[model samples]
Target: MSKRLKQLTKNADKNFNQMIIGVLIVAIGIFLWADKNYFFWPPQLRLLMNSEWSDIVFICLGICLLFTALTGNRSRKFQSILLILASAAVAMLLAEQVWHVLGAHKVEMIMAVILDAGLLTLLIRCAYKN
Candidate 1:
């Protein structure tokens, strides 16, 4: 690529990264605001409002994976591993939260399982494709 084209690509990537960071910050702010105000939210949503240690860790890992994918700095295999690990962490987190809300309901439990399985499959496929 020409020097000008390369410079443009770099600037575009930097802008994209900044945009992603800005969006994440706004999202977190919204989440915190909602958590403080929405006391009467459903049980499932209430569970999300109160994040545990594992949830924070998984969320951080997901952010790291997102940056890695955006920067394209890691090898494909390494990125794939990160993606899989992040996906599993997310699945586990969701399952744990859902369990707290719907564990007693057999039908909900089955639905959660199906949803989790579908999510995991979709994440894995995207990981491998990239």
Candidate 2:
């Protein structure tokens, strides 16, 4: 690729990463605000809040995996796969809590599962591309 094209692609990727980080920060902020303002939490979230050692360890592991996936000097395919798995784990954990809070019905559960599977497949395919 030409130098100018390469530079543009790099800048685009950097901007996209920044956007992802910004969105994640905003989502966390909203979650914290809601937690503080709301009187009740779902049992699952309450359990997490109660700070069981296992839950804390699991959360730390997930965060570490995410950090490594983002910042490690690994092959693109490897990093992409790691990123996808880490993201899915985190997303599912949060989604489960939300589902509990919402008292999710069967249809909702099925939809979520289908969506997650489809997303996973797409990410895997993208990661494998040259």
lDDT of each: 0.53, 0.46
Per-residue accuracy of model 1 over 10-112 as CA lDDT, tens digit each? 6447445333432343343345444543222355566554555444554465566555645553477766676667566647645654664465444534654
> What does candidate 2's lDDT look like per residue over 90-122, in tens digits?
455456545644663434345545554554454
True lDDT of residue 34, candidate 1: 48
Question: In model 1, what is the error at residue 52, expressed in angstroms?
Answer: 3.0
Q: How close is candidate 2 to the true structure, as a TM-score?
A: 0.37
Q: How far does residue 37 in candidate 2 sit from its true spot (Å)?
A: 8.2
Clash total of candidate 2:
0
Give the range of the ten consecutive residues with the poorest summed lDDT in model 1: 17-26
Give me the runs in candidate 1 sitting further than 4 Å from their true place: 1-51, 97-102, 106-118
In model 2, the clashing pairs are none
Best by lDDT: 1
